[model samples]
Target: MPSNRKYPSLELDVSADHRPRIRLLLREGIIAVQLLVIASWLAVHLVLDERIATLGAWGPLLMMVALFTIQTRTNSDNVWRYSGLLFMLTVVLGFKLIFLEYPLLHRQFSLAMTVLAVVGASLLIRGPMDYLLVAVLSWVLVMPHIGHDDVSDYRWYLAIFFAFSISLGWINSRTYLRALSITLQIEQHYRTLSETDYLTSLYNRRALMDRFERFIESHGGGFFMMIDIDDFKRINDQLGHAAGDQVLRVLAARLRNMAGSHCAGRLGGEEFGVIIDTLSPAIALAIAERLLEAVRNSREAPARFTFSAGLVPFSHDQALADILIHADRCLYKAKRAGKDRVHFGVGEHLS
Candidate 1:
C-alpha cells in the first residue's frame, strides 16, 4: 500500500527551528531578572535597618536561589517556572508587609513588587490562566492590608494601580504573542520560498534531496523515480520559452496529481523526482507509467510532451549519491533505448 504520509510544511519546520531560540531568550531574560533582584536586595539592605529577624532578611535570598536552581537545572518546564514565580511572589509580598514600618512605604513597595511580579509572570507564562492566577493572588494578598493603617487614605489609588498593572501586563503579553505569531509566519513564508521551485511550485533540488534523505532514514527502504522531459529544449527552440514554461508547469501539475505533491519535486529544468514508499518495484513502475500517460494526455499543456523515468529501489543503508547514480544510469539507458519509456534498475523495461 502507498503510504499516506506527507512531507511537513515550511510553517511547521520554521516553528520547530525557532523553538530553541525562544527558549534561550526566555532563559536569558530569567537570568537577567535574577541579577536585578540581587541588586534590589543589596540596595534594600543598605537603606533599611528594621528587619523581621533572620527569616525576613534571608527568605527572598533563599527564594532567589531556588528559582535560579530551577531555571538552570531544568529545561524551563512550565510547572517549575510557574511554581518558582508563585514562590517568589509569596516571599516578596510576605517580606514587604513585615519589614517596612511606614504604611506609605509598605503600600508603595507592595504595589511595585506586585507590578514587577505581574510583568515577570507575563513573560514566563504563555496563557492568561496562569497570569490571571498570579494577578488575582497578588490582589488577594494585598487587599486586606489596604485598610490597616495610614495606607487607608490611598486605598482607592492602590486599587487603581493594581487594576492598571494587571491590564498593562496582559496587554504586554498579548502584544508579545501577536508579534511572535507574525514573526513565525514571515519566517515560514521565506523558508517556503527557499525550498520551492519558483516555476513548478514543487520542492526544488535541495529540498527534494532533503526530503528524500529523511524518508530513507525513516522508512528504511523505498523507490526513487527520476523523470526527464524528452526533447524539452526543442519546445523552447520551436515555440518560445513562454510556451515551454507553460508545458513544464502543466507537466508539473500532472506529476503532482499522479505522485502526490510531497512525493514529487522538480530536480531542475526539465527534470523531476518522485519518492515511492512502496515495497514492490512493480507498483512503483506502475505509478511512473501512469505519470507518463498523464503528462501525455494532459489537455492543459500548451504543447503535448512525454517524459522518460528511471526507477530504482533503495534501502536505508544505501547512500543517496549511489541511489541517484543508479537511477541516472537507468534514465540514461531509457533515453538511449529511445525516449518516452520507463527503465528499471533491475533490468526491466517498459514503454
Candidate 2:
C-alpha cells in the first residue's frame, strides 16, 4: 500500500523589493492574455460563425475576469493562490473542447492553454511544487479524450501541444529566475557603491543627508555633530596619505561602535558627521566626550590622533543649512579655543 503522508508545496523565496515587481508583471501579463482570449473568442464567434456566446465559454471567461480583478488589488498575500485557481479553471474549460461537434472550436481551447502556460512560465518565479502545478495544468489540457477512440487526432494534437507547452514553461521559469537574480545583484552592487564611502566603509555624505531627512521627519528632533581630525594634514605630511587613510578608517570604526542606532558618515577631508538620538545638549555632550575618550585611548590611530567636534540640536521645522552652519561655527570655536574637545551651541541660537 502507498503511504498517506503528503509533502508540503514548495514556495519560491524572492527579495522583498523584487516580489512586488514580479507580482505586478505576472498580473499584467495574465490580464493581457485573458483579455486577448476574450477578444479573439468574440471575433470568432460573432464575425465568422455568426453565433452568440455559449455557456461553456462564458464560465471560464467570467472566472478569468474575477481572478484578474482580485489580482489587481493592493498588498495581496496570496496572489499565486488566486492565479493557480484561475489556471485550474482554464484547464477544466479545456476539457469542454473535446465534447464540441466542431473540430475548429477545439483550437480555441488550445490557444487558451498555450497562453496560460506561457504566461505562467514567463512571469512566475517558482520551485518544484509550482512546476508540478504547471505540469498538472498542462496534463489537464489534454485529459478530455483519454478514453475516446473516435477522436484520436484531437488527443494526439493536444498531447503534443501539452508536451511543447510544459517544456516551454519550464524553460521560461528558469530564464525568469536567472534574469531576476542577475538584476538584483546589479542593483545591490550599485546601491552599495552609491551609499558607502570608498576609504572608511562608512556611509557617505549624501547618503547620510538623505537618511537625516528621513530621521528628522520621523523622529521630529535630534542632534547633529561635525567631527574633524586635529592635525590631520600633519599625519599626511609626516607618515603619507596612506597612514592618513588608515587613521580615518580607524576613527570611522570607533565612531560606528559608539554611534549605536544613530547615523554616522564620512563628511569629506578628515571630517565626519554623526546624528545622535537625543536633543538635550548635556546628554549629547556626554556621548560626544565618551567618543572623544574612546578615540584617544584606541591604539589603532598613528601618533595618538585626536578630533574636535561641534554639536547642535535640530527640530523638525529647522532648515538643514542653518543647522550645519551653527554646528560649523561651534566646530570652528572648538578648533580655535583648543583642539581635541567637544563644543555645543544652542539649537535655538541659529533658528
> Which predicted model would earn the best lDDT?
1
TM-score of each: 0.73, 0.75
In Å, residue 303's CA in model 1 sits off its true spot by 2.5
The collision pairs in model 1 are none
Model 1 regions lying over 4 Å from their true place:
1-21, 34-108, 144-153, 217-219, 258-262, 347-351
The TM-score measured for candidate 2 stands at 0.75
Q: What's the distance in Å from true for residue 340, model 2?
A: 2.7
lDDT of 1 by residue, 1-351 (tens): 121223333232325455555556567766676667666775776666656245766777677677666765575456555655665575557545553556666655666666776777677655566778777787667552444456556767767878888898899867775666557656556778788888888888998999999998898688898999999999999999999999888977786777532478889889988888888877887888888778778888778888888889888887899888888988988999998998888744323
- For model 1 the TM-score comes to 0.73
lDDT of 2 by residue, 34-102 (tens): 566556555555653523456655666677566656655646646664564555456445444533545
Clashing pairs in 2: none
